[model samples]
Target chain A: MLTIKNLHASIGGKEILKGIDLSIPAGQVHAIMGPNGSGKSTLSYILSDRAGYDVTEGSVTFKGRDLLSLNTEERAAAGVFLAMQYPVEIPGVSNMVFLKTALNAIRASRGQSPLDAMQTLKLLRGKASAIGLSEDMLKRAVNVGFSGGEKKRNEILQMAVLEPSLCILDETDSGLDIDALKIVADGVNALRSPERSMLVITHYQRLLDYIKPDAVHVLAYGKIRRSGGAELAHELEEKGYTDFVNEAA
Target chain B: MTLAAFITRSRREQEDWKYTDLEALLASTNKTFNLDTGFRRYDEDGDNRAYLLFLNGVWQSARSRFGSVPSCILMGDLESGYQLTLGEQTCLVAQPIEMVFETDSNAPAEIALKLSIDIGKNGRLTLLENHLPSNTITTIETDITLQSRAKFVHGKILASGTHLALHEVRVASGGYYNNFSLLRGGHPARNEINVTLEGEEAQAALNGIMLLRGSDHADTTTRITHQAPNCASRQVYKTVLDGKARGVFQGKITVAPHAQKSDGYQMSRALLLSDQAEMDARPELEIYADDVKCSHGSAIGALDEDAMFYLRARGLNETQARALLIESFVAETLDNVQVEAWRDIFRREIGEWAQ
Candidate 1:
């Protein structure tokens, strides 16, 4: 349900993503694997409407609507979610209040009635317990003093609460341990459905082992050098990106 | 001296007052020049049982629950104001007591009131003042004394007006003095607090917040002295400035030579919401004691861009995200308020200002 054609993105006159194109249908998971400086994160950030980047030439559409034109908040309202590589730590606003504000804003944009305080609390409690976030954790300032695993889980909690159609997991497995990886994977797996799609961006295949992707695109030197089925991830893992990175360069 | 004479004589070019323009403030207060027609309105203090009301510098006993004045307590009208005195070892904590003052907006005259409180040895008293923003020029000097082993908790909410509020407190041995104020800027307002710990084991905490916007100006100046051994003092002042608002904080802590083991700490932080918003902070520490711990810190900054982006990406608009960040920036300063009701009042006021 997402399309990208000849997307050339740059930050500060330095080209990061050059002539990249991809498409993902609904109910599918795609893993974008690339070594360092391969424009994997640049793609995710450009899709999520992050500032400070200029898309010199390209077109990106989500569900038949131009995604590049929408602001970050509008993109979020349009069912685009990005679980950032490093979740921001916001002191003073409780996690519960942040989630509630986000949910209500999205709902208001879609002509839905906002949930009352009690209703929001109930919904949060059920969702939090399912992903193993405690009531006390939800009461604290967002991500302040949280460990890496807890930050990822908190992101997952927001994803579940927001329930965006296009979820971009940007290096969600980088800082997580084995058990923490399982927990985050379970959370992502629980949200997988015919109507939801996830772009699991990572450097290693360890995460794809947990949340299996339907397609694997090997990105190197700002281009999608190869696109294949799930086994492509195994080949890249066995023989490191020694050839793809140099070959594409 | 006339208020005009005092304003003209004050050295606005001095190092401490360099950031604020007093001449401009004085010119803006042309309407409040009335010294003759004064105190024209009365404010309903809701339930007399909850507070002692002073409307336009006049005490309304009918609007005060202390019609049945407690034992060991004496209160009556002064020549132009009111006075309350508590006997030795008296306790005023059985009921929540708030002393509220509201100015007469119609007249907007120059009003000055003196609040003198004396807590005897082992006595306890808690007081709260929630004064609304005013149109008049007002001066309130709260002079308080705590005898040995006495305890006093004082909270204040000061807002817009050409106002000057001074809190002078003296704590004897083993006494506790806690003061917290939340202030919003007027054309020009100042809250100067001077606290002295005169005896051993005395403690004082001076914490306040200044939420200034527009061209409003507020100054928070404090001088805390530790004269006796084992005495401790803390000062935390936070300022949030928007528009061309100017906020100043000068916190000075002094430790005497004989006051060994004196502990003094001061921290000042300011958040500037616009390019024109300005903050001036100075932390002065004078230490003569060899065995003392005294430290100070100051930080002034604008809103966090990364945090703002994070909130906006989560679907909150610019206003909602800004309010959340500003609220958290000043929430820690309110923690020094020991009373929850007073804390809630400050919170409600801050929420309204954020909106």
Candidate 2:
């Protein structure tokens, strides 16, 4: 469902993601594990088509289309979702309104009639319970004054509602307690389907306990040094990234 | 032309009083006259109170009446005197002061009107002023004094025309004052207000909305001072400028020494609709008190591209999407208006301005 060929990206004139290549088939969850400053977040941002990231070289293709040619919203409409590490807090814009707008934007792009407020609310309520978010949270502004766990839950709720073809989870496990981590992982696991693909980016093996990945890739420096099964996550947790670091050096 | 001859021969002659060297602005337009010719004065015999009305910068003597001796002094250029005196427990409502200026000739003018009011202890006064200028210059100065426990609310709405205009207001001690200004037109307009909370427990709220179009310029400046303990002040101003218009907001909040527990908050936001449109926002807070909560923020931005795309992607055109966002921006000020009818009027005016 997604392909990357020598993906080289930089931000602010500083190259972050060096020449890298990866491919993931549909119906699979690939976890990218790396220590700090290993270009984990950079890859996710580049895939999401976020501004300020200069594609120095390489190319990314999603579902046989040139993903680099699309804007952020177009990428969003094309079923590419990125669960940001830090959700932006937009004041005065209620979460329900925001979600509805996003949903309608995607739907309209596919020539579908937009849902009304009532229909949107009904759809939101069903997903809110699935993500463990209360109705009150949906009524408030988007991510304003939300706890870390609540924000992650909100992101998952958006992902579930949008039902993107490809999902990129960028450090979703960071700052989450054990309970939040499990809920987030459960949410991701529930969304897994044969037609959907996920690229889970994390720093630890804890999140893998709930949503097991089909493949694990050790990203050191800017390139992937190793690719293994789910057990590789446990191995990295126990042995640390010392071997990868030494090999990269 | 002499000032007296100008006032007698033609009210439009005052349009030639040039403040700036905008010869094109002064000569390109016709002499503007006041549109509000027929104004019914409020009778003071029954439960209804008195209202002072001005038409085309000319104060109507016949409309000026007093239910009783007011506790306040009324002083201005068009009219000057002690209009009424409020008792310690009196409450006034539905008091409307309407002024209209219209013109048909190209000339510069300066029309100044000043009104002063003093509220007794524990008294409440509500003043509503609506200014409609065709194409002239109008300046209004309002001096207000509130005694201990006195409260006042002033609502000012300016719609259409008035080449250059200014509205100045000042508040005094232990008084709770609320001011709301809605600006929708004029080539260049200014609403300058200075408020002072001179006694303990004094409070003030200043809110404004400026919706400018064409090549208009709208400025809303507010200066609030907290001189006593336990005083609070809040100011919020929002502007939406389209075409080549310009919107400016300068808000300053000052907390004096020993004014402990003072709380001041100010926020200014502007939305530029066109590439040529401009907005300038300056929010300043000067606090000498140690125990105080003060914050000020200003933001100048164009319509949110993400929001625009979201709206447009949902079948709304670019204009419709832009109008929705601009309405939401200006509606923040109207949301704070206490009166429902007044808010409705403001909403209607804003809708017209947006279109």
Candidate 3:
């Protein structure tokens, strides 16, 4: 469902990702584990077409289309979703309004009719309750005064509502407690299916306990240093990325 | 001497008139417009509330559905304007009261209207002032005396096509005054309000929103004086400027020595959508009381780029994302309006402008 061929990206004249090569077929979940500044998040941002990231070389293709050619909103409408590490707080736009607008925009791009307010609210309530978000929280401003766990869960709610084919989770486990981690993992686990693909980016192996990845790749020095089975995550958690960083250097 | 002549001879370079060119504005004011008694345009009061309708500086009609006559002309100025009074000693069960002034002229004239209101002890009143004009200049002054425990709310809406507008307000002893304004700028406009807390335990709040586009210019100036003990005041102003529009906010709060327990806060925020749009904010606090709490802050910037990107990543187009942020920025000030009907009308106008 997604392909990257030596994707070299940079920002502000400094290169971040150097020769990143990975491909995730439909129905498979891939994990990218790396240390700080190892280009794991950079890869996710580049795939989502975030501004300020210049692609100096290579290319990214999603579902047989040139993903890099689309803008940020277009990329989102084409079924590419990136769950950010730190969700931005929009002080006055309610969470419910944000979700409805996003859902309708994506649907419109795919030739679907817009949903009425009642229909949108009904769908949102059903999906929100499953993730432990109350109706009041949905009515509040997006991520305003929300706890760290609530923000992460809101990101997952967006992912579920949009139902993107390709999901990119960037450090979703960084600020979550054990209970929050379980809830977020459970939300992700329920959305796994044969036609959808996920690229989970993290530095820790704790999240893998609930939502296991099909394959694990160790990223260092802007490149994938190792690719192995699910055990690779556990091995790295026990050994850390020190040896991998030194080897890549 | 008439007030206009006295104002013309006043020093133009004083601290209060530094940002505003008052001399030039007065020099250009020559023509005078008579009151239009033709009620064909504003015959309907829009809502079923007691209202006072004024067209081109003349009182057209006054209707009361709840309380006695809201306005009584105590006296008249020598050259122009009237000293009208409003409200009495008791709270009225009537609907919201509206004072609407409208003009549809492109002539170079100055329309001056003065109002003096005395709210009796423990009385309550809600007044909504609507300014709907077409390329006209206006100067308005209102003096208010509130007895102990009295409450007053002043809501004003400045719609499009107004050339210039100036307003001054003064509040007295043990009174609570709340003033809210929503201004849409299609031409140059100005609003200057001065409030003095003369009695102990008096409270005042000033909040306004300015929406400007094209070459529109609008200025809002407020000076609040806390003279008695235990008084509090708050001022918040928000502006959204697009195109090559310009906005100015000059707010000052002063606390006297007798007002030792006073609390004052002032905040001015502006959102500049286009690179050429401009916003100038001057916030001042002069305090003689050592035991007072006073703070002022100003913020001016474009929409947060990261926030914009986040919204776009969620599938909103650039215009849609920008409109949402701008509306929210302006709505923060509108949320403080206490009247439901006024709030609804302001919301509708904001929605139309965003579109």
Question: For each candidate, what TM-score against the reference?
Answer: 0.93, 0.71, 0.89
Pairs with steric clashes in candidate 1: none
Which lDDT tens digits does candidate 1 get at residues A71-111? 88888889999998999988777899889989998899888
DockQ of the two-chain complex in candidate 1: 0.68
What is the clash tally of candidate 3?
A: 0
What is the lDDT, from 0 to 100, of the residue A194 in candidate 2? 100
Q: Root-mean-square deviation of each candidate, in angstroms?
A: 3.5, 8.0, 4.3
**TM for chain B in all models?**
0.89, 0.78, 0.84
Reference A-B contact fraction recovered by candidate 3: 0.76
What lDDT does the true structure give each of the candidates?
Answer: 0.84, 0.75, 0.81
Clashes of each: 0, 25, 0
For model 3, residues B271-316, the per-residue Cα lDDT tens digits are 9999999899999999999999999999998999888889999998
lDDT of 3 by residue, A133-241 (tens): 9999999999999999999999999999999999999999999999999999999988899999999999899998888999999999899999998999999999999
Runs of candidate 1 exceeding 4 Å displacement: B1-9, B12-15, B29-49, B65-81
lDDT ranking from best candidate downward: 1, 3, 2
TM-score of 3: 0.89
Per-residue accuracy of model 2 over A1-249 as CA lDDT, tens digit each: 999999898999998888888999999999999989999988987886656778999989999999999776678878888887877665555788778867876888878999999999999999999878999999987788999999999989999998899999999999999999999999999999999999999999999998899999999999998999999999999999999888988
The CAPRI category of model 1 is medium
